[model samples]
Target: MNMMSYAIVSVKNNSDKLNALLMGMKGVVGCDLFAVSYDDIYTVVSNVKGANLIADKINALTFAGVIDTLAQQFTLLPVRFGSLMGSADAIVKMLERNRHEILQNLLKVENKYEFGLKVFCDSGKLMEELRLKSGAGEKMHLKPSPEIKNSVYRDYLDKKLAEHRLEESMLAYVDAVITEIAGRLEHLGAVNNFKKMVSEALIIDAVFLLERDKKAELIQVVKDLQRQNAGLRFILTGPWPPYNFVDLDIK
Candidate 1:
C-alpha cells in the first residue's frame, strides 16, 4: 500500500490528541487516517491502494477536506494533494531529511491564515473609461494634419500608437489598484502575493497570509476597497490553513 500524505503538522506534545482526532476521520477513498511522526512534528497520512489513487475532483476534495479539518485544531503545512510514498519508513526518512525547512515553514505560519481575493472587471468598459479620462479617445479620432492625412504609413502608425497608449494605460490602472491593496494590507502586517491581469475579466488575483485575530479587519478592509472601486467586483475567500505561505522542498 502507498501512503498518501495530507499535511505536516506541529503536534508538539499533543500526539495523543492528534491520534484520537484522526481515529474518527477518513481520507481519500475512505481510507483510515493515521500519522507518521518524527520528534514533535507529524505527517498525517493514510493507506492508499496504488491503483485507487486517481486525480479526480472527488478525490481532490476529500484530500483537501482532511487537511482543512486538521488545520482547525493544529498549525500545519498542507502537503500537495497527491503526495505519496512507498512506506512509513520512507516517510520518516523524509521527515528527518527536511526537518529544518519543515520546522521553519511551520513556525512562519503558526498563527496565520490564508485568504484569497479576486478582482473582476469589464474590460471593454474599463478601457473606455481610461481613454476618456486620459483624453486618448479624442486624440485617436482627431483628423490627421493635411500633410499626413492621405499617407497610408502615417495612418497605420497613428493607429498603432493609439493601441500602445491604451495598453500602457491599462497596465498603469492595474498597478494603481494593486498598490492600493498592498497599502491597505500593510497596516495589518499581511504577507501578500499579487498577480495582475490574469485574464480580460479577472484583473487581479491575490492571496494574503495574516494573523487569525485580524480576519475581521481584513473583511472590512476588502469591503472598503470594493466601495472605492465600484467598477470592479471583489470576491474574497478563506481563513484556511496558510496554503500559500508554506515553503517546503520535497525531493
Candidate 2:
C-alpha cells in the first residue's frame, strides 16, 4: 500500500500528543491514520492502494476532513488532496529533503486561517455604468465626422477603439477595488493575493491569510466593501486551513 500524505505538522516536542491524536482518527475509507516523524515535524498519512484514490467528491471531502481535524489541534501545512509517496521511507526522505522550506511555511501559516472573497457583477450593467461614468458612452454614441462618416474602415476602427477604451475602463475599475481591499486588509496585518477579472461577471477573486483572531474584522471589512460597491456582489467564505498560503513543494 502506498502512503497518502495528509498534512505536514509541526508537533515540536509533543509528538506523543500528535500520535495519540492520529490514533483516534481514521482516514478516507477507514484507513487507519498514522504519523511519520522527523525532528520536530510529522507528516500525517494513511495506507491505501494507489488505484483506489479516486478524485470524486466523497474522497475529496474525506481528505479535507482529515486535514481539518488535524488543523484543529496542530499548525500544519495542508497537503494537496492527491499527494502520495511510494512508501514510508520515501515520505521520510521527502520530509528530510524539504525540512527547511516546510518549517518556514509552517511558521508563516501558524495560528492563521485563509479566507476567500469573490466579487461578482452583472457584466453588461457594470460595463454600461463604467462607460457612462468615464464619458465613453457619449463618445460612442456621437455621429462620426463628415470625412469618415461613410467610410466602413473608419467606422470599424472607431468601434474597435470604443471597445478598447471600455476594456481599459473596466480594468481600471477592478484595480481600484483591489487597491481598496488591500488597504483595508493592511491594517489587519493580513497577507492578500488577488486575481482580477476572472470572467466578465467575476471581477475579483481574492484570498487573505490573517491571525485567527482577526476573522471578525475581516468579515466587517468585506461588509463595508459590499455596501460601498452596491453594483457588485461580494461573497466571503472560510476561516479555513491555509490551503492557498502554503509555499512548500515536497520532493
- Point out where model 1 deviates above 4 Å: 136-150
Per-residue lDDT of candidate 1, residues 133-223 (tens digit):
8785657575677677667878797778777888899999999999999999999999999999999999999999999899999999999
Using TM-score, give the best candidate's number: 1
Please name the candidate that would achieve the greatest lDDT relative to the true structure: 1
Sequence-dependent TM-score of model 2: 0.93
Q: Give candidate 1's total backbone clashes.
A: 0
**lDDT at 116 for candidate 2?**
94
The whole-model lDDT of each prediction reads 0.92, 0.89
My TM-score estimates for the predictions, one after another, are 0.94, 0.93
